[model samples]
Target chain A: MRSKASPVSDRSKGQAGWGLKSAAWFGVLYLNLPILFIILYGFTTDDASYSFPPPGLTTQWFAVTWARADFWEALWLSVQVAFASMLIAMVLGTFAAAAMYRFKFFGKEAVTLLILLPIALPGIVTGISLRSAFSLGDVPFSYFTIVLGHATFCIVVVYNNAIARLRRSSPALIEASMDLGADTFQTFRHVILPNLATALLAGGMLAFALSFDEIIVTTFTAGQQETLPIWMFGELSRPRQRPVTNVAAIFVMIITFVPILAAYYLTRDTDDVAGSGK
Target chain B: MTTTGAARPRSLSNSFSTFLYQRPRLVLALLLVPPLLWLGIIYLGSLFTLLAQSFFSIDDFTAQTIYEPTLATYARLFTATNLSIIFRTLAMASVVTVISGIIAFPLAYYIARFASGRMKALFYVAVMLPLWSNYLVRVYAWKLILAKEGAIHWSINSLGLGPVLDWILTLPVVEGSSLSTSYIGTTLTFVYIWLPFMVLPIQAALERVPRSLLEASSDLGARPNETFRKVIFPLAIPGIAAGSIFTFSLTLGDYIIPQLIGSSRPFIGQAVYQFQGTAGDIPMAAAFAMVPIVIMAIYLAIAKRLGAFDAL
Candidate 1:
């Protein structure tokens, strides 16, 4: 009798366990359904209107999309912008973080606040302001301007990451190095750089991801040029490019997901790195 | 822990040697100059330009700038239509923030308190994935979901509730006869897009609430609700404020969702876009951008007063 009762209770527990599992599965599916639809429709024959259960399955859109030179060109431009902006962000952000970390300068707090302002402000504000400034300076919208505009906000991400990592580091290490024979450059290269390498790489990846998907700022700064997002925006607005646009969007989703996932993994072990200032 | 007195100069030569030892600081400062100059020339200078542009007006007939200082654009911003647009934008932003806050609090609590190490990391990654995808793609995906013959409508109809769904669709509360181009659609998209911002900060705050503190409260015979209200809520207010800043400011300045989903109504973002894109009125666009700046400034000031600058 005791054994039977235990079995009955175990069966009930099993049913309840399955119930929770199904619910969780359904929730995650609902969250990702839009992305699923985009991927599914990429292989569909319906070009005029996107139907829920796509009318017919076809892969011809992929071929057409691949054949288009404009697609490749836009993708290349986006890659260039993301890379350029990431490099600028890494160098600038590392130096700024080091300066603010090491010094007791006048207006330190004020300067830090100013550095964060562009990011905290709405992207539209940054976009419009940069556009206006570019026009005033008679700097025609080009790849350089786009990279410059992106770096303004991208630096904030890298700076935040680098500064957080710097804070996690013990000042005692540097002091100990100096107390020994090592000079400043030697100590930084040996001690600080190794400590910061993971964080800097993670920050750079994150900055690149942001620059890749950024549209509002790019829109104001790109002018007639088409980066991947800008090109997708145009494709989405027009009726003829719906299928091709879906393909392009899938491409973007894949590129963005990988780096961001890597970044999350790199930073996950260092939770205190995020809120160390407190 | 060495004080400045411990490092007091034994002689002028020792002081000079110390300066040479600290030369990396100077090099770091020098390396910082280029980026600082970039910010000053590009970001800060553009804000000055935006402020100056607002003083000029657009010519009515030709849609060209008059280039003369005037308050006419400010005067027009006060008109009934524009004021209503501003109010609607604010209302939408507030609604999104509140809805996201409510949903995020429970999820964030569950993850922070219940999940183990690996599960917690996976959940965090899931939350941030949507943020990395293209903004335009996300908005467009929402558009497809809310379209007349879309999955939402199809699912509702298939569930033997077609009449009820049809009636709701025909209501005046919806801007259009369909769901695609309406305020409801726009609000939903904003909530989904900004939800991650709300979750991350709240999770960070909740994680800081030590498990021992909760156990101690329970050991003292306090109920869970009592402990949550008395202990947890106060600690998490700063995180709530930071999350609200991101959600509110992002929603207010977003023109893309409104363009894609909003039918006839124009939010401030759309208004600014139109001034630049369609009307070619840069001054009017600059004036429109000031609305969010003022609101954000007030928010930042309050945040500073709360000593929440570090929260950001």
Candidate 2:
């Protein structure tokens, strides 16, 4: 009578099924609540204090954020940085993956580690280091420095995606092209490029999304220059500008959100997404 | 295929392709050089430069960093205030990491083993969507949530849990600051910001666990609890470890959450920023920055030993 036995199933089917589902939903809700706040607050008629229930809903702040020249300038700077970083990342990342994947190389592991280092290390470390290098070398903080800082991590995104895609692709596809008397460049253009196109694009979109919203590294690299995030960070200190700031933040969310969504859809069929570690 | 009667217009491309084919090593070099130069010279070079700068000390009198090699700046990091900040930051990161791990594991397990294909994709998107949102505003939203007149306190009071919430708020390290102005607030914000980073890798790891093994354990008379402890936990440790890398490191390095939520106590990131930006003490900032670097290096090393790199 004192023996405790369990009617245990091997499948994790009925073990706290409803409880776990609700817990999972709770996790998702927890993750999105702040974002929901951003969206909600953006429409608030109140501009100063963040009341729990925003007094009223208005699209006035969106218009205000859009009308501000400063907002456009910051948005433009962010776009430039994101675009430049994505281009640099795509080219370098795709090439690095192709080279390392195709050829036998010495110190390959070291190379991989080096590529991963910027992202693997803390962003503040990268930020401070870039600042140090700039000051020492008499390099001014400019768009170039910002892009360079972004490219470090953005390249890794592309590299991870490309390498995973390359590894998964059949070597025989390239071999078939070569066997048919096609040259290396021709084979690559015909077989390899087609295979890697979506992955690299997905990677680039992800990289672009990252660069667009990057705050920590951009904070150090952008001197007297305000990217959208930098501008938003500045806005946080201004108490009167709460609605405007929320509106701008909402704008950024909607902008970067698209690329991220596109990147997800593009990589969904693939077994591994770069930063996703899947 | 026409042998000798190939189109004359394709000659340039054919020759170029042939030229590339004849020199595979040259092609490899061409492909490898540009990216290597960019990452190696620009990124790693900057890091080395930062490390070298950490050896220099700032002169308060001249307000310039002395170019001489000295560990004085590194030694400067041992002050009571700085050490307190470091300890607070480390404690916060540890708590956040543990909480995130606990919360994320079940959610990840559910997504991996239970969710349908459509549901899995939705969960993945949910996990990553927050990562793309503007980070600063997210912290600000938490500021509102934890404010005295905000949703949390309001709900707590309305739900008859006011005293309970107050008692918890008055507990150690968070006394008198209210929810919005305390380390509790900071830790909450950091955990919220970084929770997504905790979910994906763990989900991937759980997904990779073979179903046959679970059936095998059951067949061997092992209960679900025993199976989880003996098999699932050990295998999933690496994924948990990997997830922790992002949560730990991101929390360790973040300055914004502390600024927006916590009282005026400085964390490592804020200290570094203030030292460099406001105080013009680059060397001291560099030295302070090394705390996180050293911590993450050790963390990564341990994680690597645990096979977290495999998950990555």
Candidate 3:
């Protein structure tokens, strides 16, 4: 009987048997193959077309990408937009989360549904809606318009993280601080902020990454301004400079990957803290 | 509290904090108003404006939007050509969602159950890395890989499976000179891009299943497959529902993949782009944009009843 129970525990580990393991690995391979292929093709020497095995290999495309002024300008614009959107989203999302956590209100669920709408609905709807609104209001499309579009969705991400963290942190801690002679500002600064620090960090990094790689909404909102993804979209139509584009693709992979990795690490252990036992 | 300092005047910041603390309603209002205004006015207001524009008609002579509320644009939307674009996008989105859900389940199950500690973390990062990476680059990489003179072709030729590959391309629905020039390529790319969205939600759902229940089922003389059929799958449905929403809506609204990799027939997204841009028809474009909004609204309503948003 003891042996039977041991086999049951070992054999049906979480009820995911051996067959599913290989299937999962296959799925992982499918997810990553194109990304790996992009890195591989980035080193190809042939500038004109892509083939399975390259005819030659060279480091020249790096130099060409380095020398291109347009690439730098596009990269800088994306950085600025991402930074501005992240800042705005962090502030607004945290405030909204705090309010929701502290009080019961009429129509709160509807507000949540509305907050989720920008990301929940299709991007084309959001894009065209904003574009039409801008035209109707006689607002010229500029860098600010792009940030507005990106921040609409970015706020959702930060709000989800902040609200989740706020819910997990015991409300009693805030009350305790006030009882100990700390004023509202001091309670928030000393007790709430430290508890929220990691979740906000994770949320902000994710928002930044999403904003940095955003293209569809940016397409409608960015009148004359070019972000890196928009630049890549244009470059796609021209096939002669394929390797340089691949180099730029690799650059994008690195820029977005670092922040995402940092975010994963920052929030991975948070489940154990902030009154999570409930 | 500076006990050493004799009767000092309170600073403005302290007094303000005290006032705010005393008035909870004011604090709540302060925290809530800015975001509410941004979302309520700027976001939903724009959506309403787009919906309103769809009801108007365009003037042919001057190429301006007529302010008179009419259904002329929607009447045009019911034309056979326009209807084809809408149906084509619907079919593509449905197929992509089903395929992504199927492909994501086992992987999600494995990650949720089999992997642990560092291995679990590694699987998570593996699933998320491509999702967080550049969207256009992944699409472009697929373009290169599926081209006539590309990796798939080379690999098939090397494996002596060239004839098989050629035969698949000759099928009526997927017919093309190469994979890159077919709707098949566009479908494949959509599934690839949205697969992670499906995986994460399903994994989260599967993780929430209690291990003791499985043990109890096994102890009751039930076979593993029987236990799974009766218990595991029903639990994962909400996650699959949540994930399908993403894959379906994204495919419905995407213009770039079909434009870059597939047949020339315009999907709903491309038609919207064209009507708004070169065709100089805002009413028509807004009308086209309403297709996805209406479909997703219905879809989300069904999913919400199934508790899909909770998984999200």
Q: Which candidate is the best by lDDT?
A: 3
DockQ comparison, 1 vs 3, better candidate: 3
Q: List-wise, what DockQ does each model earn? A: 0.35, 0.51, 0.62
Runs of candidate 1 exceeding 4 Å displacement? A1-31, A270-278, B1-28, B61-63, B303-308
Best-fitting candidate, scored by DockQ? 3
Over B1-312, each residue of candidate 1 has an lDDT whose tens digit, in order, gives: 544544553566555546766686666668668778878787898999998888889888997777788999888778898888899888888999998787677666656665555766666666778766678888888887888777777788789887886776667856465577776778778887887788778878877886667768878999977988988887777777788888999999999888888677888888988888777889889999999999888877886666455556
Residue range B193-252, candidate 3, lDDT tens digits: 999999999999898888778888878988978888988888888999999889988899
- Taken over the whole model, the C-alpha lDDT of each candidate is 0.80, 0.85, 0.89
User: What TM-score does model 2 achieve against the real structure?
Assistant: 0.93
i-RMSD values for every candidate model: 5.1, 2.4, 2.2
**In model 1, what lDDT does residue A120 have?**
87
Cα-lDDT of candidate 1 = 0.80
TM, every model: 0.89, 0.93, 0.95
Q: What is the fraction of true interface contacts found in candidate 2? A: 0.70
lDDT of 2: 0.85
Q: Order the candidates by DockQ, highest first — what do you get?
A: 3, 2, 1
lDDT of 2 by residue, A84-199 (tens): 99999999999999898988878888888888888878788899899889989999999999999998889999998899888887777777777787766778788888878889
**What docking grade applies to model 3?**
medium
Worst 10 residues of 3 chain B by lDDT: B1-10
Quality class of the docking in candidate 2, CAPRI style: medium
Model 2 pairs whose backbones collide? none
Where is model 3 more than 4 Å wrong at Cα? Answer: A1-16, A274-276, B1-15
